[model samples]
Target chain A: AQSVTQPDARVTVSEGASLQLRCKYSYSGTPYLFWYVQYPRQGLQLLLKYYSGDPVVQGVNGFEAEFSKSNSSFHLRKASVHWSDSAVYFCVLSALTNSAGNKLTFGIGTRVLVRP
Target chain B: GPKVLQIPSHQIIDMGQMVTLNCDPVSNHLYFYWYKQILGQQMEFLVNFYNGKVMEKSKLFKDQFSVERPDGSYFTLKIQPTALEDSAVYFCASSLYGGTYAEQFFGPGTRLTVL
Candidate 1:
């Protein structure tokens, strides 16, 4: 079955420091990957998505992700962390399990906390 | 940017009761979807609707569950005889199209609590 795994349940980083969140996926075919962030009491926001082209894709808020089919991973990274960046990040795999254009399978989610 | 809006941010109901969750999708969106997120668990897809009909649904979308967009209005997910397990955040999403090249817009989600 197709699935997404965010191994890190929680991460702590100092403001202004760099950050990286790990994600691994299991799928049989070419995968469409996405990163999403959710602030408290807010809806899930798209960060970036990897469809096919370049191995590295840039998202909003200076966030970027590298997709590696060999490793079956699409990890999210940021050059500088901000307190506002502290949120729950989810890695999703887009599969056409249904007719839904976005039949997404999400990871458990990694919660990031930025410390001042 | 386009946005999806879910009605009744919160709802408390007794088990076995019927409930409807409403979603106002992007004005021009053609595909609509519903997902369930249990606390501390990953969000799971429920069903997707288009042209007033259900195009696809996951196993989690039980037989008691139904989705429709009546007269090109709000897309709605109705659960007949709700179960306690149905207590979760139901997120409504829509995209101009389904498949690659379409970015899905999501709502804030409606929290459903069952007693």
Candidate 2:
């Protein structure tokens, strides 16, 4: 079974500070990775996704992530986080096949608190 | 913005009662899914439906849990004999396409509390 691991459970940063939330996955073959953000009382929104080509992918609201195959990591980064960026971020991994069931396995999620 | 909507944002029910959660996916979406999240845990995939049938379901989808889209209009999750462990935020998500690497749009979620 494919699994994801987010080492940090919570992270805090001041407004306008750079932030990076770590994510690691364990899968044998090529993996489809994704980053999602959830605001309080809101649904989870897609931040970005990585299939194969580019190692670095940009997302909305100035969010981006780099896929490292050797490291088995796909970490989310933001140059400057605003107060509104404070939310729960999740890293998910899914198999890259049509017959693999297309189920996403999620990390425990890292809570980001941007203090102004 | 095109978004999914979940009805009864919060539902409080006693144990052994049956509860049905409704979800309206994106108007043009073709794939629908259900996910569950405990207060402080990761969102776990429960099931996925497409073409009027179940595609895949995780182990977390208990025997008491069932999903249906009778008329291809509203996606529903029904839980019979709700258990205390069932108390969590139930999220409904949909994707325009069900192929690999497609991003899913999620609903605001329904908080189910079984007392």
Candidate 3:
């Protein structure tokens, strides 16, 4: 079984400030990680995904995440956030096996508020 | 980017009644999925369908829950004798393939309120 943990339930950052959201996963084997964001009344949109190779992956809207194998973490970061960046972000985990069928296990999600 | 569409953005139904949630996935996608999210909780996977069969289902998929995509039409999730606990936002997602790297596009979600 795979699971994800987002320690921060909420985060408040001023617009144009740097933002980082922490995510940790519990999985023994190599895992495929993803960051998804949900705007108000909208469906989740993919921020980025990590499978292998480079630890740092860039996503849309100037968002990026670094995958740390030793720390078992994949944290999302943005150098500058806009007011529209206020949304709920989820960290998801998927096992490498086909038997799991790529079903995603999600964290409790971190709600970010970008104050102007 | 491809888009998935879900019908009935919001639905209100009485407990013990039957309800069906509809999803129209990306035109060429081969896999469809359903997930549930209660108020202030993480979204959990319910089931995945492909090739006219259920590929995977989580324990959260209750016995009363059923899914089907007839003749490549809308992928539907039907629940019989709905309970209050079943009241939640159901999201429909679809992917071009079923694998580790497939990206699943999601619909805006259907919010079901059972009273």
Candidate 4:
């Protein structure tokens, strides 16, 4: 019953605006959390991943994510978003379970639209 | 950045026909995997392969599906008598190893269309 939930189906932000996408995961044990972005017709690109250590991890393209075990959440954030950042973002979860081999359980995804 | 490559990018096949999706994983990686994503749905795990063996597979991996990588070549996912429900974008990923310690890199994916 491991699953990821992205409550926001779509998020819109103006260029140069700060953005935050919410993600919640349900797992009994500590989880490896990741954020991935997919452009149209392209494969997913990993933004960041959190296995342990610092609660906040920085990723490529000025993206960052914070993992909270208490809340079972790993939310993605950006200080400022560009039009190029508009894409579908997925929150993925992995653990040492039968369901998680190289396989990841992904959220439904949140489509970000950067408006000018 | 590591790169995984998938072949064809797109494919169209009739129902009940067999289709094989090819994936070229990153060199020196020991773990390979396949995932399926329908439009507007979350990408789901299909199976994982390591050391030329099927390590684990989800329910989505029907019996009609099989995976192999001969002599460390392309990792192939073959589905026999594909059904319309089988039509989806298939993503191939590879990691240096399996389990929880490795990071998986993904390919561009192959869009399989079953008509």
Candidate 5:
């Protein structure tokens, strides 16, 4: 079984400041990782995804995440955040199951508040 | 980017009643999925459907729950004799394929309130 953990339940950052959200996963095999953001009252939008290749993957809106196999972590970061960036971010893990399709396990989500 | 649409952003039903949540996946997507999230909790996968059959379901998918996509129409999740515990936001998602790396696009989610 695969699981995801987001240690930070909430994060507060001033607008134009750097932001980072921590994520950890528990999976023995190769893991597919994803970062998604949910704006107020909106559906989740993919920030980025990482399966292989470069450890650092850039996402939309200047967001990027680095995968660390040694640390079992995939943390999201943004150099400068806008007020609109305030949203709930989720770290998800996907792995092949015994069934036909893959199932996604989500972290508890970290709610970010970008204060101006 | 493709978009998935979920019908009735919010639904209120009485306990023991039946509720059906509808989802219109991406036009060319081949896989559909349903996930549930209670208030202040992580989203949990409920089931996935492909080729008009349920490909997989999690333990959270209760016996009272059922899913279908008839003639490529709306993918529906029907829960019979709904309990208070079934009250939660149900999100519908679709992907072009079914694999470890397939990206699933999600709908805004249908909030079901069982009283």
Candidate 6:
């Protein structure tokens, strides 16, 4: 069975400050990791995904994530955040198997608040 | 960018009432999926459909739940005998099937409140 864990439930950062949201996953095979963002009353939007190769992947809105296989972690980071960055971020892991139907196991999610 | 549209952005219903949520996926996408998220909870996968059949479903998908993509049109999730625990935001997503890489496009979501 595969699962994802997000350490922080909520995080607050001042505008223009750096941000990092932690995410860890438990999976046997090559894990396809992804980051998604959801604003209030809005659908989730994919930020970035990492399957293989480059451990660091860049995403929209100046977002990026680093995949560390040894640590079993993929943390999202942004050099500077804006008030618009206030939203819920989710880390998801998917196994590369035919039986799984590419179903994603998502972390509980971390709510980010950017205050001015 | 492609989009998935969900109808009835929010619905309030009494317990035990039957409710059907609708989703209009991207015009050419062949894969559709459903996910549920309660207040302050993770978004969990409920089911995935392709080629007019359910390819996968999670434990949360009970017998009372059904999914259909009849006439190759809109996809729908029908829950019979809704309970208080069923109150959550239901999201519909679509993706290109049999592709080299799959990226799902999610709908804004439908908030269902069962009182």
Strongest candidate by DockQ: 5
DockQ of each: 0.65, 0.58, 0.63, 0.58, 0.78, 0.52
TM-score of candidate 6 to 2 decimals: 0.95
- Residues B22-102 of candidate 3 have per-residue lDDT tens digits of 999999988899999999888999998888999888898999999999999999999998999999999999988778778
Query: Candidate 2 at residue A96, lDDT?
Result: 57
| By TM-score: ranked, best first | 5, 3, 1, 4, 2, 6
- For each candidate, what is the lDDT? 0.91, 0.91, 0.92, 0.91, 0.94, 0.90
Q: TM-score for every candidate vs. truth?
A: 0.96, 0.95, 0.97, 0.95, 0.98, 0.95
Q: In candidate 4, residue B57 scores what lDDT?
A: 91
lDDT of 4 at A91: 96
Candidate 3 TM-score versus the reference: 0.97
lDDT by residue for model 1 over B6-106, one digit each (tens)? 99899999999999999998899999999999998889989888777788888899999998898888899899999999999999989898885467888
Please report how far candidate 4 places residue B7 from its true position, in Å.
Answer: 1.2
Cα lDDT tens digits for candidate 6, B1-115: 7878999999999999999999999999888889999998888989988887898898999988999999987899999989999999999988886432478889999999999
- Cα deviation at B71, candidate 1, in Å, is 1.7
In angstroms, give how far residue A74 of model 4 lies from its true place: 0.6
Residues A22-56, candidate 3, lDDT per residue (tens digit)? 99999998889999999988788999999999999
Docking class of 4: medium
Per-residue lDDT of model 2, residues B32-79, tens digit only: 999999998888989988888788888899999999988877899999
User: Which stretches of candidate 4 lie above 4 Å from their native place?
Assistant: A98-101
Question: How do the candidates rank by DockQ, highest first?
Answer: 5, 1, 3, 4, 2, 6
List of chain B TM-scores, one per candidate: 0.97, 0.97, 0.98, 0.97, 0.98, 0.96
